[model samples]
Target chain A: MVPLSWYLVVAFMLVGLGAYGMIVKKNLIRILIGAEIMGNGVNLALVAFAVYGGAFSFTAQGLIILVISVAAAHTALALVLMLMYNRRYGTVDLSIVQKEEVA
Target chain B: MNWKVKMMQDLQPVLDLFEQFEFFLIAALVLALAYLALEHKDIVYAVFFFGFMASAVAGFFLLLDAPYIAGMQIAVYTGGISALIIFGVLLLPRAQDSSLETFATGRVRTMGLILSGVIMAISGGLALIFPWPETIPEGVPEQSQSLQGLAEWLWQDHGVYIQIIALIILTTLVGAVALLKMEKAEAMSSITGEFGVEAKPSPEPEAETEVVDTEETSEEAAN
Candidate 1:
């Protein structure tokens, strides 16, 4: 079996890339994708730790499943919000704020 | 030698592949896909890449021997969430330029890159330095091999979490319906006010849409 540390390194890289995308992306949907990537990194790390240590492996998997469901729920709500924003403002760009500009 | 034995011999090297190399390849594929997804200017392409990333993460779970999680990842993230993202993309209006405007440029890009790099270095170094326990206690059981134990765990010990998640899903369903409903109830109230009728507030968009469906209510409100 390979050492556990390598998995951690991979997860770290994923988180870094996700953070970069989140910081740089202007589109709301792209930003959400970045957030999803970061969540995946966290899930990978949790599973890796559980697999290596053996203890809490079941719990870890359960929690990961929960995280997936919660993320789905969040994505649904976020997409609806994005749709609402698009309908209201006619664009999905994050640079525009209605309170400051319209009111 | 028999044909089966001959085939097995031929596939021996492939079957005996080390986990390390497998890990490396999967990690590389996942990272590459992630980069592509993030860098893609087209929202639809990025959404598809996101699905691929989720599928790759499911592969990682399989490598970890968590087959249940791998299946769930494929079903939920790759299948369901990707479809939702695509629908959102379809609903979005076409940009005049066809190119997404990104704020991640110049000074901001430099700062983001530096910050992410430092974070990755620190986390990687810490992981290497930390002494993780060598093995898990008495190996995870064979019975827990699939999702049997997970199902039991959810019902017996973690039932509350299941209920809570169900509640969250319900809330999200209602909230989404409200947010995406064809005409805001607030806008409807303004129309009602213009017609000089006392506006009945409908907090739920489902109700508002239903009311709009009935011409009588609208006519009464207008009158």
Candidate 2:
């Protein structure tokens, strides 16, 4: 059996990559992609913990599904926001929008 | 001798191979695809890589024996979310504003690098240092049994949560409509060219010049 720590290690590494992407990527859509990466890492870690810790309650599984549903909703809303911003400002570059607002 | 049996025999080795190295295989795929998704210059490629990453994550969930969650991951993240993101990418006027002069340069790039590194270091250290439990607890529930129990729990034990989640989803739908909807007047003007300020006349007369011309024409006509 694979050790639980192996899963944890992967989760952490994926999360780190997500954070890196979130910070370094300037495009709003890319930033959202980074967030989705982080969400996947979190889901993996949660399932791993539930399996290994003997806390394999039904609630854990249900909660995981709930999280997935919420993530979908979040992605929808975020996409809408991005579209609105793009329509209004004509740019998705965060810095450019900030500059426009300041001027 | 049957083809199905022969196919199963052929797949058995592949399954065994994956069972042995599933952890490493899925982890590497997830990380590599995630990096490609984030770092790719073309937004379209990044979106495709992200879909691949989501599928890889779903595979990882299947390896963890959470088939239900795995399916959800595939449906929601890999299919729905990826499609939505691609649509958003298409809607944008330009892919990315990565011009030579203004593309993440100087202090911004340095700061991003530094912050991401610091975050990774902190999280990596914590992951290494945490004293994780060594033993997998006995009596872990089987897959089908767990799925049944989860349904029971959702409908009986934690029923309210299901309702709450549904309400939240409904709220998201309504809120999205509200946000995306233009005012009636604005929409009407946009549809019809009557109030279109964006489409100004090519040779618009100056207000002062128009007034002076009308006065001169009146005087000439009166004389």
How close is candidate 1 at the interface, in terms of C-alpha RMSD after superposing the true interface residues?
2.8
RMSD of 1: 10.2
Please provide, for model 2 over A7-45, each residue's C-alpha lDDT reduced to its tens digit, 9 standing for 90 to 100: 887887788788877877678888999999999999999
Scored against the true structure, residue A64 in model 2 reaches a CA lDDT of 89
Chain A of model 1 scored by TM-score: 0.89
TM per prediction: 0.78, 0.78
Candidate 2 lDDT: 0.80
Q: Across residues B1-223, which tens digit of lDDT does each residue of candidate 2 receive?
A: 6998988888997876767597788888999999999888788889999999999998888887888888889999989999999998776635443451135666776887787777767766766677666455565545543667777878988889889899989999999999889977755543244224544334454776677789999999999
What are the clashing pairs of model 1? A53-B136
For every candidate in turn, the CA RMSD to the true structure comes to 10.2, 9.4
Off by over 4 Å in 1: A98-103, B1-17, B95-97, B134-143, B182-223
